[model samples]
Target: MTDASDRLASVRAGLDRACRDAGRAETPLLVAISKTFDADAIRPLIAAGQRHFGENRVQEAQGKWPELLAETPEITLHLVGQLQSNKAADAVALFDVIHSVDRPSLVAALAKAQAAVGKRPVCYLQVNIGDEAQKGGCALADLPALLDQARTAGLNIVGLMCVPPADVEPAPYFALLAEHAKRLGLAGLSMGMSSDYETAALLGSTVVRVGSALFGSRA
Candidate 1:
């Protein structure tokens, strides 16, 4: 098993190499996906200077955040999975950023929860760039209306996010997302993962949520 320091070094090296190959500036945010891993497994990564992490399930994150925060309050937690409306409140309470706001109802719920929390959790409006019905995201055409609704509801819309169809090339969809974000004047694009992150970097991804490539396959 690779020690956490080795894993951190390897992942950073990969990100740097990817950025150089893509001719893109290295993104300042690389979120190590920590879902399914225990706090003990994550602590060494934190100790090794990893401050940003992504979690998939709300319940899992709910269980992890407080303990992790106790160890490192400065850590930035990102919710990088489909967020059900019922879980919006807990998500708002837990994450520093929510990268899966795919619908207006979720947006509204997040806004309400944010109000109660007294902090506007940075939000990424998930776009179904591949138009995959099985994916959790808004239709690309509905984005403008959703943005308008988010603005009206006082939700802080920081950017857009997407999960490209697995078998297809991800660059075009990533580029499309970059274009959409530019049109909307949003600042973040939370795309890319282990497989196509280099392509995503080339196309313009501000944040890449990497899991297996960093931590190896989960047990």
Candidate 2:
């Protein structure tokens, strides 16, 4: 087996074990983050039966995925990075799920774009769980308002997402995100990454954006 295929199997096995250990009934969507690697590197995972993939940018995904997706139609694409209002149309047209809806203006742009393109991609509102200045999520205090805005603007909000402070124990943040989603009547929790996905699955993460753990270190 190729390296990507082997890693893919390992990640899948890990996910299965995590779900079993946590008594999670349904399998969380494992989004293979294919941000920098080209299609050549990604196809092995696809061939290994990885149907869900993630890309960090619309331009990069555009450069690589169109041809690949044409060849195989079942792949689900996720936009897992910060999206600009200007790129809303392109993002809505390309991705199946967007994991970075952070603010009201972005919500408005995405609503308009989805309407124009006639694609209602599932959205996850990013919460700045750690309140980092360099991050791109809405503040925790503002999430309710942002969610209301998204609903009023007619966006299909699937869940909440967050990047906990780096180098810290992410369990608390994951728990908090799950709790918030539950309180708001949301079902999905798009948290976790290569590092803490098992813990996230245990904490009710419906989507796990795994990258290096499955694809190896980026160049």
Candidate 3:
């Protein structure tokens, strides 16, 4: 089998095991992040039944996904990167899910964009779980406020998304996000990556964004 299929199979099997261990009857949605990789690189994964894909940039995804969407209209596209408030309209036009609603301005922008475009991509409030200064997520202290603002603005806030401090063990951060989700009664936790999906799954991630592992090292 081709490399992408082989890797996808591996991740699926691993996710299955993780769900079993966690006593969860359902596996989190596996969103293969196809940000920098082009169609040629992504086609194999699609051929192998990867229906959900994630991209971080508006222009980059705009440059590519239209034709792919035309080819496979059933595919679900996720915007899993930092979304600029101004690009809300562009993102709403293209993606099916937006995983970075972190601030009031973005919340307002997304609400307006959805009303104008007549398309409402599912939303997630990104929490700066690590409280890292350079990260794109809102500070942990601001999560509830952002959630309220996002919901009031009419963005369909489905759950919370986070990127923990790089190189840390990650479990604690994942658990923290889970705690927030549970407390808020939100059902989605968009966490984990190629390296830590198993742990995230075990801790109740309703969706996981995976890259590199399926597409191979971009480097």
Candidate 4:
């Protein structure tokens, strides 16, 4: 197997171990974070059986994914970054899942886009889990209202997504997101990344967006 395939296998093993350790029966969906990598870098993982892949920008995905998708039509493309209201229509038309539904305006834009395009990508409401000022998620205080607004606006919100504060034990934050998911009747928890995905899986993340661990360090 190629180096990329080996890394994919290792990550899968780690995920399986995390599931066993957590006593969780189902493994979280591993959305390979393929933001910067080119098609050549991605095909190795796909050849090894990876179906779900994530990109951070609509424009970037547009420039890179069309040809790739034509090659592999079964791939599930995810938009795992902050989305602008203006790009809502393109995002809905492109991504299979969007892990960044944050504010009311974005929520309304996405709803309108979906209505116009007739394609509703499953979404996750982003939470500022660490309460950081520079983050893109909805404030903890605003999450409930935003979620309600998104639902009322006709968006299919399936879960909560968060990027916990950097350089800290991420367990509590992951747990907090999971708790909110339960309390709010949300079924999916779109947290975790390359650094702490195993911890996230143990803490009940329904989807983990992993990048470097699978694709190797980006240039």
Q: Which candidate is the best by lDDT?
A: 4
Off by over 4 Å in 2: none
Clashing pairs in 3: none
TM-score, cand. 4: 0.98
How well does candidate 2 score on lDDT at residue 48?
A: 81
- What is the TM-score of each predicted model, taking all chains together? 0.94, 0.97, 0.98, 0.98
Model 1 lDDT, residue 112, Cα: 87
TM-score of 1: 0.94
TM-score winner, 2 or 4: 4
lDDT of each: 0.86, 0.91, 0.92, 0.93
In the range 116-175, model 1's lDDT, one tens digit per residue, is 888788889999999987888999899999999988989878999999999987888999
Model 2 lDDT per residue over 11-101, tens place: 7788788999998888788999989999988888888888999998999999999999998899999999999999999999999999999
Residue runs of model 3 more than 4 Å from their true location after superposition: none
Q: Model 3: per-residue lDDT, tens digit, 117-160?
A: 99988999989898888989998788878888888888889999
* Candidate 4, superposed: residue stretches over 4 Å from native: none
Count of steric clashes across candidates, in order: 0, 0, 0, 0
How good is model 2 by TM-score?
Answer: 0.97
Instruction: Put down candidate 4 lDDT per residue, 3-60, tens digits, no spaces.
Output: 8888988888998999999999999999999988998888888888999999999999
Model 1: how far residue 219 lies from native, Å: 3.1
